[model samples]
Target: MAHQESSVLQLKQELLRANMDKDELQSQNVDLQRKMEERSQLAAEYKKELTQKEWLIQQLQGKLDESHRKLSEANYQK
Candidate 1:
């Protein structure tokens, strides 16, 4: 009877530890998921900013090309 009681005590302790470990893992998983969501939003904002910058660059390039064409024509007339 004493041996059976000892075995039951050990099993109870093990179960407690398992519950604590499961709680800790769940907390960590929630934190990681939140961080992933934040990073995903940041990535999307960066992509939008990059797209706007690319459009501006294309507009500037077009203006530059027009200026060069005008300069070439003026030189040829001279």
Candidate 2:
């Protein structure tokens, strides 16, 4: 029947549209995943730099403390 043919045509169009939408969504998901990986790498680099700076600050503080103690001892002896 003509009505049955029309119904079949509509279903095929709907299926084609759904397939296109699914392909677009998959492409977007892949792009988002790549961006997330880049951000994660950047975050890790920043964390490493921060750790190095903290260690340097600790070393400087230790030297400053030693200098202050030596100065105090000399002054007390005088």
Candidate 3:
């Protein structure tokens, strides 16, 4: 009977340890998820900025081309 009681106590301790480990793992998972979301948001913002810069570059190129054409026309008139 004493051996049986000791076995029961050991089982109870094991169960408690398992529960604690599970809780810790769950908390870590939540932290990782939050970090992933933040990274995704940052990536989206970077993409938006890159697109705006590309558009601005295109506009500048168009203006340069127009100026070149005007200069050529003026020279021809002279």
**Candidate 1 or 3, higher TM-score?**
1
Q: What's the lDDT for candidate 3? A: 1.00
| Per-residue C-alpha lDDT of model 2 across residues 1-78, encoded as one tens digit per residue | 999999999999999999999999999999999999999999999999999999999999999999999999999999
Q: In model 3, where is the ten-residue run with the lowest total lDDT?
A: 11-20
Which ranges of candidate 2 are over 4 A from the true structure? none
True-vs-predicted CA distance for residue 61, candidate 3, Å = 1.7
Tens digits of per-residue lDDT, candidate 3, 1-78, equal 999999999999999999999999999999999999999999999999999999999999999999999999999999
Q: TM-scores for all candidates?
A: 0.94, 0.90, 0.81
The residue pairs that clash in candidate 1, if any, are none
- Report lDDT per candidate: 1.00, 1.00, 1.00
